[model samples]
Target: MDRITVLLADDNLIVRSGVRALLSRDEGLEVVGEAGDLESLIALAEELAPQVIVTDIRMPPTFNDEGIEGAKIVRKRSPGTGVVVLSQYDDPEYAVGLLTEGASGYAYLLKERIGDGGQLSRAIREVAGGGSMLDPEIVSALVSPAKDSSGLNAEQQRLLLQVGEGKAVKAIAAVTGQTPGAVDRAIGELFLVLARDASVGGKDALRRLRSLHTAILEREEQGETLSRMLPSKLAAKLRADPTASSRTERLTVTVVMSDVRGYSGIAERSDPGALAQQLNAHRQQMNAAVLSEDGTVMQYVGDAVMAVFGAPDPQPDHAERAVRTSLRMHELQRALDAEWQKEGLEPFGMGIGLSTGLVAAALLGSAERVEYTLVGDTVNLSQRLQDLARPAGTTVASESTVTAAGDRWQWEALGDHLVKGRDTPVAAYRLTTDTTRTEPTPSREEATR
Candidate 1:
């Protein structure tokens, strides 16, 4: 990694030398220039355009707030440059003034705490990465009184302090040992609580909260987009290393495919709005079932849903998980159908299939659009197996899946049959939805799409 180039600005020659010495100890940081006054600071900032600026709160030739004012001017000239204001004063107003415009790449640290065990180095690195940091003392001084007036408990007040310090939701989640989604919901609830409590400066608090929240979200949007498109675990991996998905890898996995039975006829007979609602409800139920089993829902092609287990993150019990998810999908849809029937909506019957084998999986597409997809016979066989599944709410598995699942569920053999896109017959098994119901022979028409 390249070292973080920094420009140091302080009126005191001893202070500037000490700060430079501190930064020099870390090979990852380099002091590019030194400025002792507002005019020289602004001049060097424009000339050097360093990644970060470490400046004292007061400088020469009118020593009141020149550090902050000059830093602001540098940032305005080069929006990408980060500023860390080192202040001997822990007054909340200084911190607020430094961050009033925005807090994306800013830091406020007490000069007293600068010598405390790599704290200054960490702050410099953080701001260099477009993340902000606040002195713990400053954060506490800023938000301590809001505890009672803001209607927040101890834990909520702690969370408020982290937010005020410009921590991202992901960072907050890491610190609190909670999921990002949970942290987001907590912050939203905190906002509601603050909005309800009428206290002095409540409006200012809300404005700052809104601004900080937006900055955190905007910083993590790539991860957020990946989360919506892929599994949470997979998204985090990609977020940490963007190149993780670039290469294809082969792994043992189970592919699942499900389709709404008689979907064409249902669509033809039902009203468009009602059918769309039912389809939306059906997809939601399917998503919930798959996610509960830790499966990745790949796509929804009209009435068909495709899912995979094992790739992106390996799971040894992938076959069992896929089978369990398929059963759960059927059960959930049955319950949803019962409710839809009461509203005079046609019920949707589902046929699902599972196949287990080694397949190549990778995230593919251009910069504009991409998808995590599985390749090989396993994916194709799952679709073919779904077509062979007879009756509603039935799940069919290939011989490989049945073997991999290892007698977890009693299976009824569906005699070897020639499937489309294959020369030889593929053996299949059904996890009997109804014990008494006999197997129906698949006709030539049923075998084709």
Candidate 2:
């Protein structure tokens, strides 16, 4: 299972320990960071960029509502971050303050009744999936004596919630068991209700809803547009918003070169259709992992994927981001492997390389076939390192990259070797993903000429 990265914050060590112990038992939850104050929580959230945050409702010098306040700031800065606020207070209004704008990707839980950590795990999973959950007591406190109706029927209210969660009409239809046409009608009615509310009270909230509505429309369009385009170097150009073309400039970057190990043998053994489908899925996983870290996909050569970090734009932490992204790519392949195995399909094994140094990056070629390319010794080293990583599902990085990354990741040095295209021996560090089993080290001679 690909574990969900979590950042835990609590001023009380005892409380933090209890929560950590409880969460550690769950195989799918990984507490990657911990903070003891609101400031620390915010700092760690940005630094580590965890998928979910669990924070005590009060902490720091104020010891007031710092946790809830910090959670709001986190969600504001990164809308995709899931926050679960833990509180000793049973006040439903406190929870309401944390979710006034929208309830999606937010959760409020009572610290006392976490109930063996199941509810905590469930809440994390729900918010991580862009859904909402509230303590049952909290829910009853708000809904038991239902407030005055706002002229929205139950179905219309549900549709409004879906829209706030950024679900497209087709997705809403899938969930509600309705046709797309019916969902469209419901959305129109919901919009009208929101418009009425905007004219009266809560105009600010309605404005946010309007923005989300516009997002849904644009997302639908983007899906259509992306479906018709080839996604590679052009995607990088568009994503980076590069202004110039055919102009090369020196850029310090982390270059990642990955290859699908044993692709030739798999191609010869598998049917053409099956092989094509596997390649498509593999590319999607690799591309998504790279793009998630703000890295640019440089190009694709057969079964190889080239990614550049800090190019088209300067990223000081490019080395760190590239190493972390490599781990995610490894996780992606493992998850894909399990799924494909269940269906009797060929599984993909990935070898990743990362080299951080100065490089020349620019757009090249005519309008008919333009591409954003990276050219430098760093690129060559990355390729050699990836070939050395051919022990499937492995990642190897240049010594310079490992040093630049600091203590962020655990690595096992694979010693010095003359990697092809380089005169001197370059030391390679293997990012150790599985600590329990000792992976075989690549022989220097086998790794290069």
Candidate 3:
């Protein structure tokens, strides 16, 4: 069993010690670090990258909403880390403010409710999994103030409650035994009904409902931050032209797909909390590698990382950039793995695949959630080649990618191999580095096939 890593923050040393002591009793939880102020909290968050952060809503320097501000910064910097805010006051306003940006990966609890530590433990676990939790009193405080003068039916009011709790459409559908489309329609209709009611109380309820509804919708996307999720410069273009993502464009680009070689075996043997920390570290390094070459990190699903070297902004040397990026990734991971080995943790080995061809790229989704994606055979081939890249730290590139990248490194022809979803076999090349050469030596070998 893996203990959940946590960071505690409070201006008062006694309070911090007491809370830490309480959490220490739980064998499943581990305190990795502590901070007394907002600045220290942010610094430790970036350094330790703990699974969860438990902090006082007020801290030193200002003692006013520092915890909330610090949590926001930590979340932006490390989107995977969850936050549980402890406050002496049970004011719903602070909770609302903390959650205004988004409610997922956030929890607000009254400090007085930490009697048995069960509630605090539960909240920590909830937000750690990208779920939201609010103190019962805070929920009541929020709901009681917003009078239901909009004349919502029983079913509609129930729907409102579920939405207020930050439940996703799919989750709500499963619970209510309704289709996702039906749930979405119901929510839209519910919003329309609220809009129709213009009474003072109705307006208050409507405002709160709108905020909650938006937050819940945004939760569907990973990172819960739209700007951060998009490719570099794509967000700016979308903002300048809101409809830029509405249409598809054909582009000649290079796609890179990398996956941890033995993630499943590692997961089965390692503690869940420790594995999460390791994964976060791996991802941060991979992200830096990709960004260093101006590649866009499309997504990180579990142990897999998908990146694109051209699309939102095309480059003539996309293939070369991807090849360089792949090598850099392997280099960075090796250093990271060395550090992990020192910590008595298993190091990660990545198998990367690169494919270059024409792909139809589009930003798809509704106003609430959107994803920039590449579609077509190019994308599929990259994933297929990635499967062929085994034995760890190896990179496989498609024939097309090899041609576009030019002769910069030695190549080992993989020959024509049949891949899934295709009737014909695809040609691939292994990007080989010379152990003798300190720098990349331009070379190419003729394939006899």
**Model 2: per-residue Cα lDDT at residue 222:** 40
Top-scoring candidate (lDDT) = 3
181-263: candidate 3 lDDT, tens digit per residue: 89999988877777677764655666666766665665554333343367645765665675776789899999999999989
- Per-residue lDDT tens digits for candidate 2, residues 153-239, read 876666766665557777888998999789888766665665566434434445444544554554443422233332344444544
Instruction: Name model 3 segments beyond 4 Å from true.
Output: 1-6, 13-47, 51-54, 57-232, 365-368, 434-449
- Which regions in candidate 2 have their CA more than 4 angstroms from the true location? 1-243, 433-449
**Which pairs clash in model 2?**
none
Best first by TM-score, ranked? 3, 1, 2
Candidate 2 lDDT: 0.75
How much lDDT does each candidate structure score? 0.81, 0.75, 0.83
Task: State TM-scores per candidate.
Answer: 0.52, 0.46, 0.62
- Candidate 1 residue-wise lDDT, 81-180, digit = tens: 8889999998867877887776657888998889899999998877776667778887666555455564888888888877867578889999889998
Cα error of candidate 1 at position 365, Å: 0.7
- Give the Å shift of residue 38 in candidate 1: 54
Model 2: which ten-residue window has the lowest total lDDT? 222-231
lDDT of 1 at 405: 71
